[model samples]
Target: MHERTHKVNAGSSKPRRPAAAGRSRRAAGFTVLELLIVITIIAILATMFAPRLYGNERREFR
Candidate 1:
């Protein structure tokens, strides 16, 4: 029976950044304030438009 062996090069592996560095990079996304602002804007727009949309539908049925 013959055994197959594999060779791995240590230098080929990528260097890992520190955990804090990774968290900072990942944290580049939206902050709580930014997310809240976006959600508020969406809610405001929905409130402004939703009633008009439903009103038009009701008028069409009449």
Candidate 2:
């Protein structure tokens, strides 16, 4: 009884790899369209706010 229980416990304790492999088999990285969308959003935000911040700096100098 003790030996059987020990074997069961040891088997359960060992990490299983099939489940992990199944999870990682799918595509994981970002697509090009996603990267382009992020870049475009950043560019638009910078354009919208950069001049106002720079203008404030110019006023401080003057």
Candidate 3:
């Protein structure tokens, strides 16, 4: 029978951070430019579709 021995190092006490730790520190928010772009896209889409939505609703109520 063969026995394998495991060795633990005492010099390093804190556990090593995972590879994902590098990515986890990112600030969670949209930049101003990104937010403006998203808002502009949404506004344009709403403007383009608003007439159709309101027009149909008005016709249905009559």
Best by lDDT: 1
In the range 8-62, model 2's lDDT, one tens digit per residue, is: 4455777555666865745687778999999999999999999999989999998
TM-score of 3: 0.52
Error of 1 at 9 (Å): 42
* Preferred candidate (TM-score higher): 1 or 2: 2
**Which clashing pairs does model 3 show?**
none
Candidate with better TM-score, 1 vs 3? 1
Q: Candidate 2 local accuracy as lDDT? A: 0.80
Put down candidate 1 lDDT per residue, 1-62, tens digits, no spaces.
99998666687776655679868866779778889999999999999999999999999999
Strongest candidate by TM-score: 2
Tell me the lDDT of model 1 at 18: 63
Error of 1 at 33 (Å): 1.0
Q: lDDT tens string, model 3, 4-50?
A: 98656688876666888877665667678999999999999999999
User: TM-score for all predictions?
Assistant: 0.54, 0.56, 0.52
- Least well predicted 10-residue stretch by lDDT in candidate 1: 9-18
lDDT of each: 0.86, 0.80, 0.85
Ranking by TM-score: 2, 1, 3
